[model samples]
Target: MQPAAPESAAPAAFSYTAFALSLIAGLALGIALGRLLGPLPGGEAEPWQLRAEDRNHYMLAIALEYHESGDAARALDKLIALKPAGDPLVALAEGACALGSGGYLADASGIAALRSAVQLYQDFGREGCAERLLPEAAPAALPAEPPPPAADARAQPTPLPSKTPPPASAQTAQTARLAPTPLPRRFREHSLRSFCDIARPAIIEVRTVDYLGRGVPGQRIRVRWGESEDIFLTGIKREYGDNYGDFQMEEGVEYAVDMPGAAEPLATALSTGSCYSDNRRGLKSWRVSFVEV
Candidate 1:
């Protein structure tokens, strides 16, 4: 079935930059790279490289995430020894770099160069070139120093005020039980960074027909995000299809809202790989004003 059009109350403006991820998975590389790159053990870049070409995109991705979250210090630290990216991922990095630079990304053309980098990698059939290049990195940090000798070993440590007074394990369990469980959104899944703050909320379910209006299971359903990009979270599980339905969403999140005359929340959210994806088309992605209980 066709997915509804994308809509948003606050249109998210971002660069459509792409980058070559290492043929290696991000999780695998984090183990050693953290130390090798002068960081605490167990961090980003899993399945990381000990080779060149493979290291570029994954490094770029790490840099981008840090840049977007406004952690310039960390992002710069990662890119300190890295080379300028080529193709596909270069564009992706450019977008993240712009965000890292502390300047407003007024429009999509904001990081067009970065997007081209991702395309470059793809064009060369090195979609995930696994290059682990390490021409040189700064020297590792010094080991931590031992604590200073104390005046009296027998003295009891000063009592510290508890934060929130520690909750009893039993009480904590009870509170968890009382909280509303997040019913799984069967279609929630994403490949790229899905923007939870900007998207349409109209959730669409697709079902195939066997001549009867019954339900068709196991059909490929496409939910496109917005005009800015042709991102569609495709090949969803069929169980959720029968309910081509509406479900209320958490407030302060993006949604493809339900059509007033339609069955559910207007397809008001964009598609996250997991329920909502962030698509920036330079339109009205926000509400002028509205009251809600």
Candidate 2:
């Protein structure tokens, strides 16, 4: 009653719940419209919107396709569409270098094919550090020796010779056969040379051959750089000759090449720091040959 408490009016409480509901509804509506309308005009397509790593993979796919189809114009157009900063060939080389350095050459499927395609492009006047990343092409399988001419099924055994030999020359030949003849050494470093060639940079070319000087396929060549080592077999690249297996070198690092049973490395202290060719620089290469002793 006390004059009706002066009817002191209280301000209405703010409706936080209503504000939050409105915000959520508006966001959902925007999303729905965006989905219906798709990407805005002038926006990049799905391929172009890929991240750097994904983009590289896309380029690799294009390369592989090109390799299979042998369509240069199509491949070039596809690569140029990627919006690479400079020459598309450079991008191809960079991708190849990345894959090689990342150990893709070790065992990944299709990696060799990708590298081969990249190398094809690299040969078109764009060079990168990918030359050495390429693995030797697999050697053609050797034909098995025909089973010793099947022994004649109907032939008779020959008569035994009389055991009355007393010749001095025969005796000397027998003694020589009994005496030990030194076995030829299995392997030796034949030659080593360092030079610069723009076409092939930072390459450590290895060739393994037999006593007859024919390429010895399946021979293993080891390359050592600091604490790391890589073993590659010859005959992988038939085009390079069956005896050939090459390794790529990194800048500022020393490398050594050796065979399994060799007394020492075919080449040591090999580096690419000083070798230069033409107006370009830094593609020092070495050639090492190994032969059966």
The per-candidate count of clashes, in order, stands at 77, 3
- Per-residue lDDT over 1-293 for candidate 1, one digit per residue giving the tens place of the 0 to 100 score: 97765776355574334223542455457856765775434444333322344444445465335423434445445544454332223333333333424332232332332332322332222221111111122122222333355568786665533223123574365334332323322322211122233345423333233333343222222332333211121112223443132232333344443222111332345432333335534222232111111
In candidate 1, stretches whose alpha carbon ends up further than 4 angstroms from where it belongs are 1-49, 81-293
Off by over 4 Å in 2: 1-185
TM-score of 2: 0.37
| Count of backbone collisions within predicted model 2 | 3
Cα lDDT, model 2, residue 171? 42
Best by lDDT: 2
Error of 2 at 69 (Å): 43
> Model 2: per-residue lDDT, tens digit, 181-268?
2343467888888888888888989887878897765456778888999877665565787568899888889887787544367546
